[model samples]
Target: VDDLCDRAVKASFASAGQGSYGEVSVLLTNDLAMCEFNSQYRGREGPANVLSFPAHLRSAHSRVEVEPLLWGDIAISFDRVKYEAKCEAKPIRDHTAHLVVHGTLHLLGFDHKEMLDIAAMKRLEVSSLARLGISDPYSAGVNVELSAL
Candidate 1:
């Protein structure tokens, strides 16, 4: 998991043109903790597969001056990852890698609030995952179950 996370973070940073000097803290937890975070931070119920809390929200074009930048925190629900992977018929590692990359992109100020933004984010995610030998998660064959992340 640690190795996968390292690669995913590196790939995500590179894709966002953030170089490879930042730090990202990842928290692997269960559904209960994730549920609490989802409610408190997102004002939503139940657990999300992953959520990002940026140390300083900035787009790829922003100039960052902090030495050894602390990018952000990523909270991942292990239970949700497992469930989603099972539902999608994908390897757990692939699912986890995708989520880590997605959360890292979010930390880099990439959002899906608009259609263009969603496409841009997904492109970055697919390319970053490709660098890590993971496939595009948004492929047509993938199934998104209601309870899955």
Candidate 2:
């Protein structure tokens, strides 16, 4: 899981034009904990597959250079991942990989709040997943060209 997450984070950062060095904390929890987090943070009722909390960095002038910056935190619901994988008819590993990439992208300031934004973010996500040998998760009749990513 750690190795797959490392690859996903690296692929996401590379696709988003970020440096190789960085830090991201990942939490693998079950639905009970995830449900609480969803309610507390997102104000949603149910657990999400994954959620990202970006560590908004201070200004460049106020920080000191030392090690890789702590990008953010990502919480993934194992229960949700399993359920979604079965429902979507995708391999569990692939689904997990896609979610990790998705959460990493959110930490990098990417969002899918709007139509255009969704397209752009999805492109980057698909590209990153491709690097990990995972197919696009949104290939539900909507085609996304990898070359454009």
Candidate 3:
């Protein structure tokens, strides 16, 4: 977990191409725990994939509330990741890297709520993964059906 977290932060710094000194604390747990977290925080039904909990909530907390520049904790459900990797016919490492990058971008405020924003976020994710020596996980050339798994 420590090594993966380090890689995730390094990946973020490399993607941003800036002097960002934020840490990504990683937790690898079961689907049940993640499902509870998702229900409480995201109002989701069940476990999905990676979940990012940003540490610094500026609006809700003040200067005396928490750390000055704490980034967040990224909780990854290995079960979900494993399932998705098999379903997508992608290497688990590559799939996990993609999700880590996705969660990092979320912490950095790169959302995909709109069409243009989705494209921009996808581009950034692809470029970042490339820098991390990971190919685009969602390239359109794969002739695999996710449900068939």
Candidate 4:
């Protein structure tokens, strides 16, 4: 858990750009809590691997310093991470790094709804994880060619 938090904080700060004092809290909780958060904040039902609740409520003039304000919270499901790691044959730490980076990217106004946007977001994640010595999560677990079976 310590390692997870450390890596997540580093990733969040790095992706937030320079002088970004945003503080993000990463929570490792059970599926029940995750489900509640998902429904309450996202209007969805079920436990997701990771969810980011950015300080969404901001005034028009808040953009200049949104980087320094308390950004938001990211919730991750440990069980899901472990299952994914084992299934994909990757270390849990690496998977955690990917998820953290994913959530942080969301904080930075990146999304996967568009191809170009996805490519850009992925590039940033790959580069950021490299700085932390984490493997390329974009092509790891659940990414291997298991069709041979």
The numbered model that scores best in TM-score is 1
8-65: candidate 4 lDDT, tens digit per residue: 6676557545344657677887778877877887777777788876665433223453
Off by over 4 Å in 3: 57-68, 141-149
lDDT by residue (49-139, candidate 1, tens digit) is 8989888857654666663568789999999999989888899999889889889888888887768887888899899999998878878
Q: In model 4, which residue pairs have backbone atoms overlapping below 3 Å? A: none
| RMSD after CA superposition, every candidate | 2.6, 5.6, 5.6, 5.7
Candidate 1 Cα outliers beyond 4 Å, as residue runs: 65-68, 143-149
Residues forming the 10-long window of minimal summed lDDT in candidate 3: 58-67
lDDT of 3 by residue, 17-120 (tens): 53466566677777898888888888877885777777754321122333336678777788887887887788888777777777776666566666886777
- The C-alpha stretches of model 2 lying farther than 4 A from their native spots are 57-68, 142-149
lDDT of 3: 0.66
Q: How does residue 72 of candidate 3 score in lDDT?
A: 80
lDDT, candidate 4, at 13: 54
Q: What is the lDDT, from 0 to 100, of the residue 36 in candidate 1?
A: 94
lDDT for model 2: 0.77
Which of the two, 2 or 4, has more lDDT?
2
